[model samples]
Target chain A: MYAIDIKDIKKIYKGGVEALKGISLQVKKGDFYALLGPNGAGKSTLIGIISSLVNKTSGKISVFGYDLESQLEQAKAKIGLVPQEFNFNQFEPPLQILVNQAGYYGIKRQEALIRAEKYLKQLDLWGKRDQPSRELSGGMKRRLMIARALMHEPCLLILDEPTAGVDIEVRRTMWAFLTELNKQGVTIILTTHYLEEAEMLCRNIGIIDKGCLVENTSMKSLLARLETETFIFDVDPPTHLPSSEFFSIKQVDEVTLEIELDKNQSLNKVFAELSAQGVRVNSMRNKANRLEELFIGLVEKGSKNV
Target chain B: MFNHNYFIALKSIWRKEINRFLRIWVQTLVPPVITMSLYFVIFGNLIGARIGEMNGFDYMSFIVPGLIMMSVITNSYSNVASSFFSAKFQRNVEELLVAPVPNYVIILGYIGGGVTRGLMVGFMVTCVSLFFVDLQIFNIFVLILSVICTSILFSIGGLLNAIFAKTFDDISIIPTFVLTPLTYLGGVFYSINLLPDFWQAVSHFNPVFYMINAFRYGFLGIADVSLIWSFSVIIAFIVALYTLVAVLLSKGIGIRS
Candidate 1:
């Protein structure tokens, strides 16, 4: 059974703001899925509905075949949500927060204590477990939320912008922890603005725009949709630049060039043209993350269509 | 979920609530005791010296039950109101909302906390009363029942207030304007018999009057209203308030988007 199966779910706020308009999607069990969207794209709202934090206006949602309406407890038991905001009691210690969360899921105090310790240690928060959560740094508080969510040992975990304000080191650590958790057969759904993180961790991706699911496909397929790839080259200064019908080249500086190559173009032709100019070929890299380029293109296209 | 799981969830919420108030004991527990002591000093001792006897007993003995009941009612109501509202304001209440615990369990757990605080403050005030008057329990069962039922009733009131409250100021409005007036005019110090017939009839309409009288009956074996009538009013309010809280929770009125 799918970890989460949403069918045409819609959410219109009290003021008639349509946060979501008929979003339907599914994530297979044990899959690491990314739900990517721009600001106010209904990603958090959709996650809120799946976790029962927000009341949906219409349609149905099920977790592991348990209907959210009929079997709310069962469905909720299967999922853990790390919301985008810091929602834990600031005065409470991390240990108390995690243990209390486990208790809410009906775990005994003894077991809750053990699980809390395990998660605290796993999230690199063991030393700070006894400290008030508010005293922790921004990144530490985010990890505490993750530990609290995992205390119940849910089969499906949903993290919404879990590392939004975190530094690179902490974000990488979280990514490793999540990857390890997913490898252990836990279904994970992540919503993030970091397209590079999504490209690295998630196999399948769903892009939401204006409360609609604009692109839902494998990451490989989505990346393949990029019509042109931009690369930045570090080359020896040249008197002239190469010109080609398939490649768009521009001199960025004395020794740097920006080149955009179409899908059907070959780097060999561009290199031969550069060689004719007697400019030494040097190291080159993509101007931007491939997923980021595709994401921008898709969001722009979707906006124009709207 | 299993029955045991529900019990566990209840225990968790109760423990969390208990720890919360206890963690700030000086704020939660100590203030009520101090406030009650001042009342005992001012109302029971200094004022009773001049007032002489009331309801066939010394004025100090007469007002003891009412004072204790006042503490119980106020503490119970405020405990839940502040805790729940703070949770809402901080957005930490989502921890419970997103959990598998049933909504009824959530309600019960918070009520449990409110009752605990109410009774704790009540017990402390009763102990303080002992220093002024040799306390006597006319009916232990009635005393316990009245206090517990009253605490439960007001605790639910607090929950409803917290749910509807948009800001911190909103939570205090009911206690300041509504609760204080009702308790003061509920015949806590002077018996309603001292009022004219019209005012006495008005006292009958104030629910706090029934609660204080029922509790006073437990201590001094005298009441302004019948025991059956008092219980009926308390139970009816409890049922109605509980139903309102349950409906609000099910609708996710103030807690959800």
Candidate 2:
């Protein structure tokens, strides 16, 4: 069974705001799936519905084969959610928050304490466990939420923008931790604004646009769809620019060259042409992250189609 | 869901709530005890001196049950209201909502906390009243029943108020405008017999009057209202309010989208 199977779910908010149109998707068991969307594109709404925080207007959802409507408790038992915003009590200490969360899942106090300690130490929050959660830094709070979610040892973990404001070093640590968790047979569904993070972590991708599932495919297959790529090359100072009809090259500065190559073009040919013009290349990299370009392209295409 | 795990969940929520109030004992426990003490000093001692006996008992002794009941009612009501609303305001209520806990378990857990605070404050106020007047328990069963029932009733009332409340001010509105007026007129300090006939009829409409009189019967064995009628009203309100709270939670009225 899939980790999450959502069938044509819809959520029309109180004031007639249709936050999600019909959206159907599934995440395979043990897969690291990325649910990408622009702001207000119903990503949080979807996560809320799956976690039973929001009520859906229509359709159905199941977690690990347990029906959300009929076997709600069973379904909830298998899933844990880390919401985008900090949704824990600010006055309580981190240890209490995590242990209490485990208690809500029917875990006894002693067992909850052990799990809380394990997660706190793993998340680098053991020393600050007794302090009020409000005293923790922004990244620490995010990590605390993740620890709280994992206290129950859920099979399916859903994180909604868990690393939105975290710094690069902390983000890397979190990524490593999550990768380790994923390797331990936990299915992870992550929604993030950082395209490179998604590219680096997710095996499958689903992009949502305006309450609709715009694209869903394997990461490799989706990346393969990019028709053209732009690369920035650091080259030795050239007296003249390279002439090529197969690709377009422009001098960003005296030594920096920007080249746009279509799918039909080869990087070797570009290098050969640059050598022929005596413009020896020092280093070359994509001008923008590949996944980011494709994401923008897909979202823009979706908007135009609408 | 009504298994060992359910019990654990209930206990956890109850423990969290108890810890929350105890952690701020100065704010939650101390203020009510102080307020009740002042009421005893001014209303029981000073005021009772000016007015001799009321309903065949000394005025100081007569108001003891009402004052203790008053503490129970207010504390029980405010504990659940403030605690539950704070959870909602902080959005941490999502913690419970997302868990496998049944909605009724959530309600029971919060009510358990409210009842604990209510009974604790009531016991303390009773201790303070002993300094002013020598108290007597006319009926142990009735006394325990009235106090526990009244606490449960008001705790459920507080949960209902919290479920509908949108802000901190909204939580206080009912206590200030409705609860205070009803308690003062609930025959807390005087018998309904002392009021005019029309006012006596109106006092019967105030639910607090039944609770105070039932508790007074428990203490002095003299109630303006019948014990059976008072217990009946309290139980009926408990059932009604409990049902309403359950419905609101299942529907996710204020806590969810």
Candidate 3:
């Protein structure tokens, strides 16, 4: 089942700033979908629309087939949004805030308390339950937001920049927690500037740019589309760089050469050719598939033409 | 997945509202009671003795209802306005907007908090008035209804003010310029009947006048205007303000992209 189905979704703010331009995408049930985009690429705007915080000029959205406009209450009830900004009543304790969120879902006070405790503990925040939200560290605050979203047991969780400012360790912990949640059948939609986070966590990704979707595909397909492999060959200083027809090479530093080689191009052939030229190779390794490289290529290419 | 469980949202909002006001008792509760006591002492006891026997009731008794009404108005308006503005200021409002809770629940929850503060403060002020004058609840039912309704009306008004307010200065502008002026001229300290006929007709237009008069009628069973008119005006204001707020929230007027 599709967890979130957004079709022909368009959002035009006043003064005709088209923040979403008839975007369409589907998030499969239990899938961790990442929306990747640069600043001003409309990732937050799209999340805002799906969460019903931003009004759409026209679109059709459904959560588990409940129409967002017609069956708004139902559609909204199924989805939980964790915004990029930390937004909770600071004066309220973490547990109280979570319980209050449960109340919004019409959960009974007793049940809300139970659920709040359950999620807080799961998020490793139970220890700080009675502390006001303002007292928590930045990472803890983000975790509290996650706990609040989960209190209603929502089927679809949309996190906007969940780890934007978090330390690496905290982000890893959150990633682990979210992975466990996904394993238990919660569908996740996330937007982040961190391409590695998306590359690691999401099975499918969509790249939006200038209020339009520029690319959307499964992780494997997207990486595969980049057919060329990047290789950083560690070499002893050569008198001059090799002009090889087999590879595109650039001297990155005094001792290292960066080469872009297609799959059809063989490193062995380059090594044999290098041996023939008596160029001493110190070390060599194929670069891992990094989304940052791909993202830069895509966004830079797009920006150059416009 | 979209379930329209409005009651759940309502209970959540109401709980937050109650928690917010009750948590800050010194800020929300105590100051109003002290202010009302000062009013009772200076205006009711000290001044009422010099300006005695208006509308066939003791000066202290006549001003008691007005002071209570003033407290209710200020408390109700300030409660929602400040709370909502603070949420906006702190950016916490985004959480509610994204939650499953409907906009109406958000509106009602904040307003409920305001009404709680207003009525609670009003009740305390009424009790304080009792120490200075002989208490006579001439129309207890109307007094209760008037306070409750007026509290709701101004609470809604406060929410509207918060939506329009862009800064801290914006929040105070309404209460200072509009609300304070209306209350002072609302026949709170003096009777409209004692004014010239033209000014009495003008006072009829002040919504607070009806609220205070109706509340006073509840105490003394006497009013400068018809009690029914006072009740009707407060009810009308509630309906009008609720619609405006509902429309603004549904459109995401202040809280959206």
Please identify model 2 stretches exceeding 4 Å from their true place.
A234-243, A251-256, A275-283
In order, the interface RMSDs are: 0.5, 0.5, 2.1
lDDT of 2 by residue, A1-306 (tens): 999999999999989999899999999999999999999999999999999999899999999999999999999999989999999999999999999999999999999999999999999999999999999999999999999999999999999999989999999999999999999999999999999999999999999999999999999999999899999999999998777888888889999999999988899999999998888889999999999999999999999998
Candidate number that wins on DockQ, 1 or 3: 1
Q: How would you encode candidate 2's per-residue C-alpha lDDT over B106-223 as one tens digit per residue? A: 9999999999999999999999888888999999899999999999999999999999999899999999999999998999889999999999999988999999998999899998
Work out the TM-score per prediction: 0.97, 0.97, 0.94
Query: Measured with DockQ on alpha carbons, how good is candidate 2?
Result: 0.89
**C-alpha lDDT of candidate 3 relative to the true structure:** 0.87
| Candidate 2 vs 3: which has more lDDT | 2
Candidate 3 at residue A109, lDDT?
86
True contacts kept of 1: 0.97
In candidate 1, what are the lDDT values of residues B1-257, reduced to their tens digit? Answer: 44999999999999999999999999999998999899899988888889999989999999989999999999999999999999999999999999988888989999999999999999998998889899998999999999999999999999999999999999999999999999999989989999999999999999999999999999999998899999999999999999999999999999999
> Native-contact recovery for every candidate?
0.97, 0.93, 0.80
Candidate 1 on A164-253: residue-level lDDT in tens? 999999999999999999999999999998889999999999999999999999999988888899999899888777676667889899
* Model 1 deviation from native, Cα RMSD in Å: 1.5
State which candidate has the highest lDDT: 2
For model 3, the superposed segments whose C-alpha errors exceed 4 Å read A233-245, A267-289, A304-306, B1-4
Question: Candidates' lDDT values, in order?
Answer: 0.93, 0.95, 0.87
Chain B TM-scores, listed for every candidate in order, come to 0.98, 0.98, 0.96
Error of 3 at B60 (Å): 1.5
